[model samples]
Target: MKFLVDAQLPVRLARFLESAGYDTIHTKDLPHKNATSDTEINSISIRDNRIVITKDSDFLNSFLTIKEPYKLLLITTGNINNLELEAIFAANLQFLSELFVSHSYIEMTRDSIIVHY
Candidate 1:
């Protein structure tokens, strides 16, 4: 899977994903440290068939302008501590990987995960 990690995430997550054999890009790698807008990031991901991994709801509105994105992984825990977020994913990586392998939008909420295909 290919992913575009949003600015809210640590860029280190990208390297981790890469080490797992996924194509991953982090916003920090863009031109200037704060150069990207969520819309532009969404557009690039869609145009290139990459899934958007974001904590921002702003991207949920990108559908207003663009017609596609391979998928979206919305982490809805809200300002979760970095270690907590990492631990959650680490505990569920296998399920998450399976979900991503099959769906378009996956919302991971505090109590449940909803996958939209």
Candidate 2:
């Protein structure tokens, strides 16, 4: 699976995904890092056929309209740092990947993961 880590996530998560053998891109590492907006990120995901990983609620609106994203993984833990966010994903990689592979939007909280097809 291909993934585009949004600005809210640490670029390191992209490295982790790459290590897991999935294609991944970190927006912070791009040439126009500071210039890229959420819309641009979504557009890139659409063009490259990649799933978007974000903590931003704006994506929820975009997904509602475009619905072209392969999948969306929205982390709802709130204002947490990158390390904590990474830990959450690491702890639930299997379950989360399954949701993505099924091409669904998943809202993950501390105790539960809700999938919307």
Leading candidate by TM-score: 2
Error of 2 at 90 (Å): 1.3
lDDT of 1: 0.76
Can you give the lDDT of residue 9 in candidate 2? Answer: 78
TM-score of each: 0.82, 0.85
After superposing candidate 2, which stretches have Cα over 4 Å from the reference? none
Error of 1 at 82 (Å): 1.4
Residue 18 Cα positional deviation in candidate 1, in Å, after optimal superposition: 2.1
CA lDDT of each candidate?
A: 0.76, 0.80
Per-residue CA lDDT of model 2 for 1-117, tens digit only, reads 788888877888899889877899988876678468877787888888888888888888889888845568887887777677667777887777777776569888866788887
Clashing pairs in 1: none
Question: What lDDT would candidate 2 get against the real structure?
Answer: 0.80
